[model samples]
Target: MSGRAENMIQLIDVSKEYKMADSCRVALQHINLTISEGEYIGILGLNQSGKSTLARLLNGLLKPTTGQVLINGMATDSPQEIRQIRQLLGMVFQNPDNQLICPVVEEEIAFGPENLGLPPEEVNKRVDWALELVGMQEMRYHAPHLLSGGQKQKVALASVLAMQPRYLVLDEPTSMLDPLSRREILEHLCRINQENHITIILISHHPEDLLDAKRLILLHEGSIYMQGTPKEVFKDMEKLKAIGLKRPGLYQLIQQVEEEGYRIDDNIKTIPQLVEMICRI
Candidate 1:
């Protein structure tokens, strides 16, 4: 945890509710959180646990019913500051099909910068840079619809990266992809966080996806159920199961090996680590 880092996003006593003719449903309840700049934070929850709602609030796509959401010290509720807030924070959704607007990949990547009224030369530069960043430079002129699921997702991510946002909020960006694609997207995001110093707020249901995050936040029934380092949070199997979540496959395997009288270290998170530990035994 980087305690010395400054806060980039803050939620203070925030709550969100949707009103219906018959009843009002609360999506979030009195939540308070602070996300520092350059931090990789993963949000974990089951469906309808307010994960998507929280992402929208962070980027000002949805307003909080109560309290406040502040991005870089600017209030999300302020209409005048909304544009600036959005420019500083980029959001990618679960469906790449919905996010891909332009027919061509390069055009889609340039859309955000073009909207900002950047010069043509600047827009072209950004498009090229974003394509390279996502390892999609060869697909620049390709049609988005003709690409694979992972490629489309990479194009969508390139579009967001083109804007050069200081913070990126992803809501289940890998949910619709194949297993290999999911791993590729996660690896790219990890690189973006480490090399670019961009703050990442990733919402995911996969236990393995949360392992690399500096902090993991678990939401249950519209409230924060747990918050801690990945190891600290996932080690509590009983609590996670009660909240409808599961431990990572690696963790479960390690536990089973320990039960078989093998002195495996409980903290091993990767296959290489496990193999190295077993060799020492």
Candidate 2:
């Protein structure tokens, strides 16, 4: 959700399809997108709107059945080819436990670089840097099973970042955390993007999650329904509601104010921003 704006990955005529019992199940179609480096994009849409499938395509987990996902000018094919692409792109999942296959935290973070055949010094350096990046260095020796839900997810992200991936593909990375923990994880991610200039592509449903995006893209029925800066996209409150997307609580309050005969800009995107606008008015 709330994201930065920088593109690092590009998709050219990307599409995905699966064979069903009697017909073909098309998951994505003609997804032509450009993800600039160091940008954080919040991808939202209804279920089965190709959000998840799109995330899989970014880091090469699932290859497009039709087109190609170009990662830093390289074409990817299998999981092995993907391994090379992943050197620049990293993916974090919704469920941290599923991603945390190893028992210890450091081991999980090291798995990626080790697989890439880096020297022990390099792996150790990455492990240290990534842990420090996510503020998880102290827990490197802890058991994954013993960590909190938010901690686990952060650890998963650190594992990916340790690979020094310039592009980070996150599929609902905060979905499972409690509200406070969710905020914490998102804040840390924002710091990573701002300070480290890492590109972030986040797939999420919550409008609140998208508050920080330099851009927001909504995928609907296998196509882009809408896309713009959060202020632009969230302005279409009625349209978003029609698509089962809830506006932020602050937005709803502003809508209420407008209906009550108050003159409002109707373009406010966040609670604090709205407050500032109202104060000046």
Candidate 3:
């Protein structure tokens, strides 16, 4: 939980550019990053900040225009390794509907392993395990369309988890949900990363969603502007404000209380923790 496993996703001098009839656009520029196995990281950026482009580049959905993307030393651009790379690195999108293709929940969870040519018995085991992992075993027979937004997202996550990927990259996954649903999804992600030891690269614009991340990578206009722990990055209110991101509500409150001559632990995350600290004072 403190350090990471050996395998890594390396991006070296990577850039992505789009070409139209008469002009070109750069989504990412000379980006370099390394994601180690079992590490939970957050990628933060505003809209059009190349967060989605970066996520797609991880699983070989998009090739970098300039440099290299290597998954455990296998180049993502290689036709032979792209399939394996994708299998090792699963992706979840902003909309659950976009990823949940199968009609039933169990089938959706089984789809990845089934396509991997796993044995029927193995596939069934994976399906059951994934459903339980996401706490969706009771809804295994439910239709995807009938489920709530949060349930649908859980099914989508279970579908990816069924494949047993070494790394999971999610792009604005909780953006479409209500606050409670969003919190639920983020909590599930924390549990998934901690319990299963799967490396998680969570891409989102919301600072609140990334509070559980072990490391934070802040992207501004497609380049990494800052990288640190959530405590380190969120404490710089002026810098975050300049980048169009606000400090999380809880952190803001902590700062305000501290400014009023109260001491709060740096690890305080919830309102109850702050309340307890105040009561102690």
Candidate 4:
């Protein structure tokens, strides 16, 4: 996270509830958070932990039942400002099928910018740029529905990237992907955050999916349970297990080794770092 970057998203005492036939279900309860520009944040939780609800709140897909959500200081509850808010914030959901609507890949990627009424030349530039960013330039003319699952997800991502949003929010974007594809998507997110300086708010239940995040916010039931960097938050293994979240296997192994008095450098995060630590020992 950059110290000088301004706050791009803020949830001030936010809560959301859904009305059923006879009763109401509280999906979120008083979530107060701030995400600064150029930060990669992970929202971790099990099912029914308000992860999806929070994601929707950020971009004004759903208004808060109580409190407020602000994007770059613009209130989401304000309909007049919502269009601009959404333009500044882009969301990528779990299923690519829900987002991909165009017949061709380039057309799908150009949808958002085109709707913004950009000139043909500018739209074409964005379409080409987004496709290249996601490595989908080769498939620009291909039909979106016929692509493989991973490819479809990439196309979906390219579509959002074409909008060139300042903040990107992903809700379980890799849940439907295979292991290799999931890894690829996560790597793409990390690269986007670092190279483009776009703020990334990734929601997932998998700890491994969030390893690249600069900070982790753990949600339980309908409120925030804990928040910190990956090392700080995942250190409480028993607490995470109690909340129905699993730590990555490598993280578990490293924790156990450290428990036995082995000195593992705090800077060591990935497998390569762990291997180097072991070699030195």
Candidate 5:
């Protein structure tokens, strides 16, 4: 589905700096970006490359040291506007254990709307909807701590969804889960973006997780090194390796096959596509 053409989030010349005891470190430097409504964007970078810093800036968790972060035309730098900005942006972190607060799954999902002083009826409606959206309706009474890592992440996601934010910023939300769980979370995110019309900003290191994104942004040393579609970005294996990122195994294998003087389609992404190319050869 195509996102609304207008900019939903804008970062204009944004930079973030942290002041240590004796020195100041720049986490992001003069970064400018625009995210349209309902867009699915993946952010990739090595450790300390400012991925998390960028996420925080989008949600008003951290103010930019120099530039402005605008959420739907509202500036996040204003203290009074931070709350409003946060209501429009929801953030899911890497660890679900740290984010889930309530004991039961249902309460955890309702916590956000309850804090907003929503009526009990509205809160229940939101809780029910969020639970169903994440496919955790059966686990409403389950203890979050006892659930598997993937289930816990889903609950955490439900909590964020209950808030009904226009934008969702995920900071490596699946890093702790197993591969199956990671895929589940990513699939749910895609559904959320497409069906729910929520803009998704996913920060992940896994190439597979980024394949479905409409755009991919690569960060290096606090700057945007490259930004493009997954096919466009991953085409340059040497550049990805230089940035401490690896090409998908399938892509690497395709490269090797090409080197052996075999003709293969470079644009192929899925296994079936590869199989068809091999059969044709």
Candidate 6:
């Protein structure tokens, strides 16, 4: 798919600083960005980088120390603006346990719309649609505690979807999940973005997490390191390694093309895609 959509988020020269006991910490600097609706985006960085800080800024959880953060053309700091923007932007944190407060699946999904004082019928309709969208319809009555990590994440996704948010911000949603659960969550996110027309802004360290995103934005200390398609970002293997990121194992095969001195287009991004590309060559 083309890496373009309706512009849903815009951060104009945004900066953030936090005051500590003796000193101030600079979390981010002059970061400007725009997110389009239905576009799958990944933010990659090492631990303690400004990835989470940016996520918070998106939903107005933290105000920028300088510059402006705009959502759907309105500045985020205005109380009236934020209240309206927040309804269109929903966030999911690293742990599903923290986000899931209700005991049952249906109630959790209905919580957001219910708070808006939506009619009971409308709320129920949204809950049912969100549950089925995340493939959790069968488990609607199941207790949240009984769900596996992957299932819980799906329910978390359902909760966000239930709010009918146009944009979804996930701050390392799969960080605590097992490999299987991680894949499951990632797959659901891909399907959600594609089928539901929901914009996705994800922050993660895992390269696998970038698989479904059309573009990857690398953040260091508090700056944009690079931004491009996954294949474009992975092309510079040494640059990625220098920044504490690694390309997939298939990247080794791609590098071999240079060793053999061939000018072939080895822009394959995924292992399966790489295998097929090589076989076709």
Question: Can you give the lDDT of residue 230 in candidate 3?
Answer: 86
lDDT value, residue 60 of candidate 6: 94
* lDDT tens readout by residue for model 1, 4-84: 223478898999998999999999999999998899999999999999999999989899999988888888999998999
Candidate 6, run of 10 with poorest lDDT: 1-10
lDDT of each: 0.89, 0.82, 0.90, 0.90, 0.89, 0.85
Poorly placed runs, candidate 6 (over 4 Å): 1-6, 257-269
Candidate 5: pairs in clash: none
In Å, residue 180's CA in model 3 sits off its true spot by: 1.6
Q: Output the worst ten-in-a-row residue range by lDDT, candidate 2.
A: 1-10
Indicate the TM-score of model 4: 0.95
Deviation in Å, model 5, residue 108 alpha carbon: 0.5
lDDT of 4 by residue, 109-130 (tens): 9899999999999999999888
Residues 8-117, candidate 6, lDDT per residue (tens digit)? 78898999999899999999999989888889999988887799999999999999999888887877788888988889899999999998999898999999999999
Q: Give lDDT: candidate 6, residue 268.
A: 55
Model 6 residue 139 CA deviation in Å = 0.7
- Residues 1-281, model 3: lDDT tens digits: 22222499889899999889999999999998998898999999888999999999999989999998888888888999898898899999999988888889999898889999999999999999898888899999999999999999999999999999999999999999999989888888888898999999999998889988989999999899989988788878989889788878888888789889887776676788889889988
Candidate 3 Cα deviation (angstroms), residue 4: 16
TM-score of 1: 0.92
Model 2: how far residue 7 lies from native, Å: 7.8
By TM-score, is 3 or 5 better? 3
* Clashing pairs counted in every model: 0, 15, 0, 0, 0, 0
Clashing pairs in 3: none
